[model samples]
Target: MRLLKQLGTVAGVALAGNLAVGAAGGGWVASLVLGIATGLLALLAYRWVVRRTERRRPVEVELAGARAGLGAGLLVGTAMFVGVIGAIALLGGYRVEGWGSLTGAAGLLGVAVASGVTEELLFRGVLFRVIEERAGTWVSLGFTAALFGAMHLVNPHASLWGAIAIAVEAGVMLAAAYAATRSLWLPIGLHIGWNFAQSGIFGTEVSGADTAMGLLHGVTSGPVALSGGAFGPEASVVAVLAGAAAAAVFLRLAHQRGRIVARRSRALATATV
Candidate 1:
């Protein structure tokens, strides 16, 4: 019942946000403004829903370690994406075409911020956390990651390899971020940094969506395996490997912190009651 309420609230707020943004039209600045605003509103709504449904303390929901999580996530995410993209470039898989306009760059930033915040809140902050309370951490992680990747199947040029890549790279990594820190800020920062660097700076597609003109007008070459073809470098083997390595590290940290919650046994609970 609690989980259902939270999901309903999140969906309602998200739909309203989409409607508001759509009403604003296609201008980049307008989209950016609406996106950011909608993200903020969704966050507030999440807090309210959590409080009302779960009866959690403010500190528990807000997380005292959010600042630290945000900083670490920003550093790690930026470094990881840079390394992955740089490797593709070094392998002759990417090239610089030229430069792009400032407007496009700003618009991309907005998209990144909105996506980072809203998605983290919906997936990690609500769904995963709720499931973890009953089903345990590992189960929640697997389910959420799979769902996240599956959700991208409708994206343009999406492929089997691309969906798998997203599941392992972003889905697992982002969920691991939340597990390690117990805060949405870390995952949100990581998502924003990764997307912004990929499309807004390096001039590449993000899950088959073309970014606005980035700082560099770059393009990928080489084999589909290495270059990631139309779905971009996320489908490349190196990217998946790099993201896996990072996820492993974060999972280790989470384990050390005793953050891996185990599922409660039904028999033990029934006997206790």
Candidate 2:
């Protein structure tokens, strides 16, 4: 099946890149780099397969979508960051950890961008689209979203609750990213910005990995029940709800543009034909 081949591509890319960079001991960095590239390649391969099968030119990644998504994402991310601080303060879990350097900020920014670009392309772009052809859109989206969230369970401090929260919250964000212009950039921007703000800027744990630098350094004070423990802020209910709500807004807007069902249905029809 094409989908199975797509999965094969995923594994191949990961293996190839890892082998190439392993000699240099890139470790997580190398593995991540390979993984991201693998994801992008998978997306490209999917695009090629779908376009050929449907007799459509593969849709280019949209610049306009990327720009617009970036703007909307920044605004939304900023608002959420502000809100999280308020929530933290209200819960009496706030602390100020001096200052994080500009270099550190830049590094975090790099991390956000790389991680976002790689992840969105893999999960939202390749896997989502590939599965959508055989499965329906809803099935593809929900399955990929849940898979994406569950994949994080391997993180240092992930919990069952955290996995669930990540699945739902991050799932929403991932969907919105794909829906916003159907280009994948919006979700990438939203994802990168949200994670950067949550981890680097706020100094909160990002899915259990200790952020190396940012504006504020915050340690979780409340029980793991509220704070998400080592799994970072993603495990928190607040983050889950926030991501879902933002995604819902994107979905509503996309539906109005008549972009939701038509293209996907067309793709399905072509795939079957």
Candidate 3:
């Protein structure tokens, strides 16, 4: 279990390192390479810090849980694709263009895996877990959501609305997704699916990447108010509505399954008392 967790942690660091390097006055490929190579270096450095903090010598994590996480991730992908398409269609004049070739498509897979692996490590593995230990599980989830949204501020086409919507819409939901599966698959899936659909299938900028692929290009005349202007669809109000609805659905499902964090909190309280 510890080894598997370490692997996930390392993969995440590598991806993040690559992104950080790619963005550091470095060109695209350079950033990608550097960000990926060293993301886990931070974890390696901090290993000693956490070694004393872990619970009873790591037990074997369940493969069934991990596999289930993959399935959840797929579900998240499908929902985001559907939601983005529905929202964009309502906005109208959605056109598609700039899609790359097969190589580009394959490159997208790399991008997704890198992002999924890295983001989860940062948010779920580190931030969320820390918050959970300090506060309760639900509090940690909320904090992580806020952090997730804040991170978007740095995305290419991010607007204040985009960031806020991400916080409320995506941040909370993905955290919930992570909490649900214990495995990173669900959250990673949601992240990849949401991003891929936004840029790949829809042809709009995912965040502000200015997609090379033009999936469904329609013409929007207004100040990109309807479409997502320079910042891309993520900034649009449509994304907010769609994202909120998705979050709601996720919460509802969690509630039905008795998985809501509040219940966990109450249980813990009872145990303490």
lDDT of 2: 0.66
| Per-residue alpha-carbon lDDT of candidate 2 for residues 1-273, written as tens digits (9 for 90 to 100) | 555554555455545544655574544455445545654654466566655555665453544455776677666666775686567557766566577655555556655655666566667766877666556566776888889888888888777788788777777567755765677766766777777787668777777777666777666767665566677667766677777787787778767776464334666677775
In order, candidate lDDTs are 0.82, 0.66, 0.60
Candidate RMSDs in Å, in order, are 2.1, 4.4, 5.7
Better of 1 and 3 by TM-score: 1
TM-score of each: 0.93, 0.77, 0.71
1-273 in candidate 3: lDDT tens per residue? Answer: 443554455555665666575567554454345533453354342353346456432211234455666566767675766665565666573644434444344444445555665666667766775566546667787778887888889988677777787787678777766565455556766776777666545555666676554344423334455566677766666766776777777666766776555424666756754
What ranges in model 2 sit over 4 Å off?
Answer: 1-60, 262-273
Show the lowest summed lDDT stretch of 10 residues, model 3: 55-64
What global local distance difference test value does model 3 have?
A: 0.60
Q: Residues 112-201, candidate 1, lDDT per residue (tens digit)?
A: 877887788778888888778777999999999999888888999998889999999999989987898787888988988888888878
